[model samples]
Target: MPQKFVLRAAAIAAASALILAGAAGSASAHVTVSSPDAKPGGYAKLVFRVPTESDNASTTKLVVSLPKDHPFAHVGAQVKDGWKVVKTTEKLPQAVKVGDVTLSEAITTVTWTAAAGGVPPNDFDEFALSVGKLPEGVDSLNFPAVQTYSDGEVVKWEELAKDGADKPEHPAPTLKLVTAVTPVAASTEVDNPDTLARVLGGAGLLLGLIGLGLGLRAGRTRKATP
Candidate 1:
């Protein structure tokens, strides 16, 4: 191959690799809700995906906080291997009516703890739950989560997304409330674009600019020499 052609090919290859790496990193960033088929004022089964982030420890515990104002009338968790699921309930100061009944209490938090083993570094686990009568009053539900590592490190996933601002570093997992439409799959992973993706994309763009500058400089030098 010609030297110039080889150099150009190498630059293109490097850019492609950068783009893919950025994509995968963004995909595995944090805990997310997947396979959400819930509609406003309806029941749906959703899966929570948690990725182990500690390099020195395994993820041993997770606590997902439900919305207190728009609580789920019914929420059930699926059994997991080597893990215990616990629901903590709190009494409401004022009763809220639902489906011809008045209720004064609700499940505020769902916790999962590993019995023997846990999700190791670079690994992930998914927890499944069914919730009904999703609050129709809000546009979405925010489920802040607390993750505990085997080394006692606690990471809070409670940041909220601000209007017209970048996504919070540790934004809480959210489930948007939308009008009832065609039913979706049992669960789906979040495909939303994240900050890492944008940054990696910018890296790719920079590489293109560098190549353009090289080409223009080469053309000027050849003309001056002739």
Candidate 2:
């Protein structure tokens, strides 16, 4: 093999490694909102995915702030083991009619403190909330969150996306409210792109090895003949 080819291959490998590392980092950088049954003027179960980026610390608590402007008629956290849920409510500035009766107050904040082993390092957990009658005429809703690590580090995922600019490093979890859409998988992990990428990468590598083996066998046979 030529020295130039070897150097080029080394450089290419380094570049590919960097690219994959960046992709993997971005995939689990911040919290995300996912829901398969989210639609306007309907009850939807929103699941917030929280991935612990820390290497040695676990996530101890999560605080999610709900929008006060367009208050949902109801908001309730689904029961999850190993977590203590706390919800706070306050009087609304102005009364709004939901169906027949007017609402006086709404849940403003929801905090979940880990009771057991919290989220382990390099792992993720999902918190589900059942909120009803999502406001219409809105494309999406933003849920700002505060993540607390066991190492006394706090990360605020609350930056809204700016137009015509690069994405924020810690973007708030945003859920799109659609009027119509096809059915999707119940589990958000099934739709994870990272898993798809890993599967494809493995398959491609296997095929490449097989092709290299066939080429070497052919070259050896040709040299052994004449």
Candidate 3:
């Protein structure tokens, strides 16, 4: 091959590799929520997990904004050691149910600040809150997040809302409320009609093709020789 052609092919391969690497890096930067469950008119512990670009620099601080429309939106958070918790309340149009009681409104924002010279790089921290009395007539919750980086970079993990949806731009984490269903019974393994027919059909076609190829080769060899 010509030297120029070889160099061009190498450059194309390098470009393709770089493109793939960039795509993978972007996918890894998403923030996720862990350990979430809420029962209607009940309290639960919600934990938010924030993964940084550089785990080396510990996550300095995290701020979670509660949804105003939620029943327990203004509920207070349980205090944690080694961190300072700040709560901001907001007024609501109607009352929200907490257990047997109804609350007029709930806290709007909850921020957790680390101690001075806080968590170092390359480490993770957990922010836990005791949430009380989830609202009624809701199945799922979506918690939006705002993450702060050591290098003065802030990332917002808020998604856009859809039509006729109760979702917010940067909503708080959510939980699913499901009723338990009992299983009826388990079935023994039996050959599936469609799958079995397909498997047999494929095997027969493969064998037929192999046989035809062998017969043609044998006939050609005979004609080529004596």
Q: Best by lDDT, which number?
A: 2
lDDT of 3 by residue, 1-226 (tens): 9999999999999999999998785545455554455566677777776555674555666788776667463355657677788887777788866666677867767887766644566445667777766666776666677777667777777775677997454444554665446444323222657767888999999999999999999999999996
lDDT of each candidate versus the true structure: 0.85, 0.89, 0.68
Q: Which run of 10 residues does model 1 get worst, by summed lDDT?
A: 183-192
List residue ranges in candidate 3 displaced over 4 A.
1-29, 55-57, 73-78, 97-99, 161-172, 184-226
- Give candidate 2 misplaced runs (Cα > 4 Å): 1-23, 26-28, 181-226
**Residues 63-166 of candidate 1: C-alpha lDDT, one tens digit per residue:** 99988877778889878999999999999778887655576998889999999779998788998889877766778888999999999999999999999999
Tell me how many clashing residue pairs each candidate has: 2, 0, 14
All candidates' TM-scores? Answer: 0.71, 0.70, 0.57
Clashing pairs in 1: 35-187, 35-188
- Candidate 2 local distance difference test against the native: 0.89
- C-alpha lDDT of candidate 3 relative to the true structure: 0.68
Candidate 2: residue 192 Cα off by (Å)? 28
- After superposition, candidate 1 runs with Cα above 4 Å error: 1-15, 18-20, 23-28, 180-226
* lDDT of model 1, residue 99: 59
**Between 1 and 3, whose TM-score is larger?**
1
